[model samples]
Target: MPQSAQLTPEELVEVAQKISELLGGKVKFAVIGGAACSLVRVASDAEYRGTSDLDLVIQPNKSYNAEVISNWLVQKHPKIIRSVEQFGVRIPAIPIYRGKDEYLVEIEIFDVEAWPNRQQYNIADTASNPMTTLTFSPDQYSGSSGDWKIPVMHPVWLLREKILSQYEREGSVKERTDISDLQIMLQVVDPKSLVLSAHNHVTALQNLMAKRPDLINKLRRAIVCYPVFGD
Candidate 1:
């Protein structure tokens, strides 16, 4: 199911805060995707605002009780309906709809049976961004409003994910936003480092670009001004 309307930054923050309260200090969560960018105001343009869903990576404590958390969500927010979809492993998503607007939260769980060997790498160690990397630690990307704080993805990795997404999506028209997002990011972040980080995981990117030769050109153009080439 999809949402008819998107969530404002304020409303999105509210949802994340409630989720933070539920998870408390026990479960660790880091957000990725458009909502994460929006939270940090990465691209301060109209095109990059109002994301439809909040994409998060949740690494629950070994003692994480799914039923208890699920029950708490339903009781706290009756509009929050839960559903699980299997894309290799079960991905639990909660879509909260009120009146005419709807917001979705997508959680990616770590240490799963499907993914036998899970590696936890920090953005500072991997992506070569100097501004936030020096003091920022891994899996500690968070935002706050008053007393509540919620995690967000590191910008370096977020840019990598955006580039990876652009490579995966077909059609010049369909991938325009993804391309624009990458361009916007490159303007601020180090394009060479981002591309190098992406190349580190080249197997997946290479496969996707194999079918979309045109996308390679698009990626190249986005980083053309940078020191690195998409080759």
Candidate 2:
């Protein structure tokens, strides 16, 4: 398979909107990974580093798993989408194209239930928590040609995921970007709120804290660096 080109933040939103439309309103999904960070950055007016592919976590219903969704998507729009390619084995990803022959970004789909350590991270509530669910308006941030409201992984959860990724993929090329994203999210999210919310998954929090002590220090510094002033 040829390497797909990178997509700007705006283009990512445009592609997300198309995917949402294709999936229809019944399917529940949220944008995660670098694509989610791009949306958050655009919404926060922070600089967005383009992402190579969009990561989406979908809640498969009785009828739809990653494979089923991919097949359905291709069947729905055969001309626009070339094909859905399966990648990886442990945590398989379905990469769906957004164009016929050439595309800027690829959409990588993952089943939320099948995601590794789903219970540890409590990832099922990714879109359930209103606080951690960011809605990206195309008109406001992307200037896209639709009123599409994209569901994104909010900074609090995103921060946890990034820290985990940093630890898991240590010394890899992606680790640097994960660290950079963590820095950006720290500036945007409330340390106190994040810590309080983390209590819901004590074991996961403990494991992460134990594995990545530097992240704990970063969170500690975040409290002082971005103090919340009371009115």
Q: Per-residue lDDT tens digits of candidate 2, residues 67-101?
A: 67766666767655545344542222223345665
lDDT of 2: 0.63
RMSD of each: 7.4, 6.1
Off by over 4 Å in 1: 1-4, 42-47, 65-148, 172-174, 187-231
Give lDDT: candidate 1, residue 58. Answer: 49
TM-score of each: 0.57, 0.71
Cα lDDT of all candidates, in order?
0.51, 0.63
lDDT per residue as tens, model 1, 92-178: 456666776554565444322223332332322333322221122112323532344566665556566666666667466536566
Error of 1 at 93 (Å): 6.6
Clash number for candidate 1: 1
Give Cα distance to truth, residue 183, candidate 1, Å.
2.9
- Which candidate achieves the best TM-score against the true structure? 2
